[model samples]
Target: MRWALVLALTAAYPLIVYFSLGHVEPRYLALLLLVLGGLRWLAGGAQVVQARWVALAALLLAASTALLNTSVPLKLYPVLVNAVLLIVFGLSLVRGPSAAERIARLQEPDLDARGVAYTRRVTQAWCGFFVLNGGIALVTALWASEEAWALYNGLISYVLIGTLMGGEWLLRRHLRARHARLQA
Candidate 1:
């Protein structure tokens, strides 16, 4: 489906960059692709507004990060290119789905209400994390220091870890509530 294609493209970018550039680190590229591919998979499966938005935000942030990588030195061209791509990705995600669409999907008889709510909350947290990470990256790009890059990268990794934890928590809470409701 569309999600599979997006995931493939996301994975391909890093490989292409590594093979073509020959200077880019394979580990970094692989990590980026893995994160992006995972985000796309999550977004496609998301049934709540918050989860969808969070996945979208993560995707945009990842794309922006990739674009920024192309301009570590004094290169205005890569920055401009990345900026445009970021805008495109942002607009596409926003226009693609509405909260109503997610809500409708969640309203199915077989759907667990608590699970949907938790998904929404976790997605919102992810959106916040990505926004913060992107802002830090932008600031670091302007300042241009090795310390800045290190700090930004570290923060991004922390955000991703936090997101995973939040997701797990949400799933657990949802299951607990579902169990209680069923008992009642």
Candidate 2:
């Protein structure tokens, strides 16, 4: 029930923006919705440490991107929506189930210490990317033209996706090497 609500909220974001402001390009909004919906679906099935971390990272990135592009002024709604999102992200980072927990739930647990470490590394990297992009957006919002916001959004989207793919590849290599060492 809760998951459904979360998914609905995420899916409804673009529509909310569209109805409220009525100015966003439809193609861009559609793209954003498609990416977000895909991420939400992927997250539901992610059981591996790396996959879960990447999914979480993607979710955070999607939420932040939505907030950045929202047409309504931040001040009007008393900023509650943004506040709730930050709280949810922070709690997920702090107390949410780890990949190990998910594995345990599945009863096929192969507790690899390296996998745990890699998950942590990926999570930290994602958090770093989120913070860095968020900071840039803030600076642009304050000091630069609003036009810069779109550029920041595009750059962050491309760079974060690339970083996640690269990180996953490196983690896979590390896992294989560790497995080979154990066999040897």
Candidate 3:
């Protein structure tokens, strides 16, 4: 329940900022984000390297927003999220058992060498995705209008993420079927 609330709040953050802008002060929004960050950090987000870095970045953004009394910091949240994700996924490629491999293991504990390689490639693809997504996010935050920022961060980005995940799932299914036929 706690994690669900946190996730929901985080997902709705862009819209929240967009709607609240001009009506509510940016500092108050920053306070809300700071509280959310604290909740996530306390709720075991700090246990993982990726989650911890994301939480820390969010906290820093919130603090900057509060101090500067500007919406720029608040808008930079999505950019930071993409950056943190990129770093985490990219690092996993350098280390053993890439992020996708770790996730694949949850479903298939006895992943073969082929599976490991596939997951590693998937992890690399995610790194590429993060780079492109993060660049767009940075552009939206810096020069785009508030509506454009909200539209991309709130709607378009999620659609793109879903598309990537769905595409990957389809490809994995096809590969699995081909491997099964070959083995048979």
- TM-scores for all candidates: the values are 0.38, 0.46, 0.94
Candidate 1 RMSD computed on C-alpha atoms after optimal superposition onto the true structure:
9.5
Q: List the lowest-lDDT window of 10 residues for candidate 1.
A: 73-82
Model 3: C-alpha RMSD to truth?
Answer: 1.5
Superposed Cα deviation of residue 82, candidate 1 (Å): 12
Residue-wise lDDT of candidate 3 within 1-184, one digit each (tens)?
Answer: 7678877887899999999999998988998778777767766543365666677888999999999899999999888878988888888899777999999999999999999999999999999999998899899999999999999999999999999999999999999999899999
Tens-digit lDDT track for model 1 on 35-93?
65465556555334433543455455455546665434221212332343444334434
Query: Model 2: what TM-score?
Result: 0.46
Candidate 2 Cα errors over 4 Å, as ranges: 1-90, 99-109
Q: Model 3, stretches more than 4 Å misplaced?
A: none
Evaluated at residue 181, the lDDT of candidate 1 is: 100
What is candidate 2's CA lDDT for residue 63?
55
lDDT of each: 0.48, 0.48, 0.88
Worst 10 residues of 3 by lDDT: 44-53
Model 2: ten consecutive residues of lowest lDDT: 72-81
Model 2 Cα lDDT, one tens digit per residue, 51-156: 3443445445445545575432321111232233344344545775443234334753564666555555555555555555555655654565444544444344
